[model samples]
Target: MKFLLPIFAALLLSLTTVNARAAEHGTAEEAIALINKTAAYLIDEGPERTFFEVSNPRGRFTYRDLYVVIYDLQGRIMAHGMTPRLVGLNAMEYRDDDDKQFVREMIERAAKGQTGPVDYKWVHPQTQRLHAKSAYFRQVGLYVITAGIYK
Candidate 1:
C-alpha cells in the first residue's frame, strides 16, 4: 500500500508538470493564430475601408478599440486600433521604458519586410496585465500588419 501511494504521488506530480507546460505553450500558440488571421484580413482589405463595416456598426475608428497595429515599411504607424496617440506617429521611435523591448524588435524586423512570428513578454498597454505576446506580421504593399494578444 505504501508503494502504491508513492506511485500515485509520482504520477500526479508528472501530470501537473505536463499540464503546466501545455497551458503555457498553448496560450501563446492560440494568440499567434488569432494574430495571423487578422493580419491576413489586413492584407486582403488594406487599411482604408477595412474597418468601415466594423466602424459603421460600432463608430469611427472602432477598430482602434481593439488591440491592433498596422505600420508601413518605414515603421510609420499606418493604422492602430489601440491608441489614438499612435496614429501617424513613427512607430520606430515609440518607446515605453517600463514595457519589454519585444514590440520594438518586432517592428524593426517587420520594417525590413520580414514576416513571421515574434514572441515576448510585456506589460500590456490596455489591460495593464503582464503578458506574453505572440505577434504575426503580414506584408501588404509597403505596409505590414501586426496582430497580437496578451496571454
Candidate 2:
C-alpha cells in the first residue's frame, strides 16, 4: 500500500496547485474590477469632488491601509489620503529611488489616460515595511487611489 499512498499524496499536491492558481486569478480579477470602479467614479464625479469629498470619507474609514493622492498635470500633490501632513507635499523632493520611480510611473501612465495595474513591494513611510499596493491614476483628474497591504 506504500505505492498507493504515494499516488494519493501526489494527487493532493496537484489539487492544491490548482486551487492556488485559481485563487491568484480571482485576486487579479478583483484588483482589475476595483481599478475600473475607481476610474468610473473619478470620471463621473471629477477631481474637485473626488479629492475633497470622497477622500475625506475613505480616509476616515480605512485610513491606515490606504494612502490616496491627487496630483495636477505638473506633478504636484493636491491631496493626501489619511495623512494630512502630506497634503501640499511634493514627492519630487523624495530622495529614494523606489518612491520616486513609483510617482514617476503613476504620472506617466495617468497622462496617457490609463490606470496602472497592481504594483507590489511598495514601502510605507511611517512603518517602513514592505507592502503590496495597487495604484490607480486617471488623467487630469482629482484623485489616485493607492491601497497598500502590509507585508
Candidate 3:
C-alpha cells in the first residue's frame, strides 16, 4: 500500500542517520590520547628512538588519520608522521589555507609550558583534500610533540 511505502522510506532514512553518527571516527579526546601516548614514548625511549617511531608509517604512533609531529622549542620541525622530508624544516612561518598561524600558536603554547589546540585547514594525506584539522601540542622537556584530528 502507499502508506507502507512511506513508512519504509522513513525507517531507511532513520537508519542511515544512525549509521552516519556511529561512523564518526576522530575527536579531540583521540588527539589528547595520541599526545599522551607520544609523551610516554618520548620519556621511555627518548627523542631519537621516539622520533623514529613517530615518523614510521607502520609504527605505533600512527592510528587512523592521526599522526605525531615533534619540534624543538625554537619551532623547527624534528619529526613528522606523514612526511619525513618535513623533518629539519622550520615551519613556524607556515600558514593554513585560511591564513591561520597554526604552527606559531603551537610554539607559543609550548613556550608557555601548556598544551596547545590549534585548528586550521590542511590537505589530508590520505584523501589529498583539504579538511578542518585540530592539532594539540604539549611541551616535554626540551622538545614539543603534537598530534591532530581531522574534522
Top model number, lDDT: 3
lDDT of 2 by residue, 33-55 (tens): 44455456667877666666435
lDDT of each: 0.58, 0.55, 0.85
TM-score list, all predictions: 0.54, 0.53, 0.82
RMSD of each: 7.9, 7.6, 4.2
Give the local distance difference test score of model 1.
0.58
Which residue runs does candidate 1 get wrong by more than 4 Å?
A: 1-46, 51-66, 95-104, 111-114
lDDT of 2 at 91: 64
Instruction: Answer with 2 or 3, whichever has the higher lDDT.
Output: 3
Which 10-residue window in model 3 sums to the lowest lDDT? 18-27
lDDT of 1 by residue, 2-121 (tens): 879989999999999867644443343444454565556656776676433222423332332135566766677766655545667786645444444555677667767776567766
**Candidate achieving higher TM-score, 1 or 2:** 1
Query: Cα RMSD for candidate 1?
Result: 7.9
Candidate 2 segments whose C-alpha is farther than 4 A from its true place: 1-46, 57-64, 93-100, 118-121, 125-128, 132-134, 140-151
lDDT-superior candidate, 1 or 2:
1
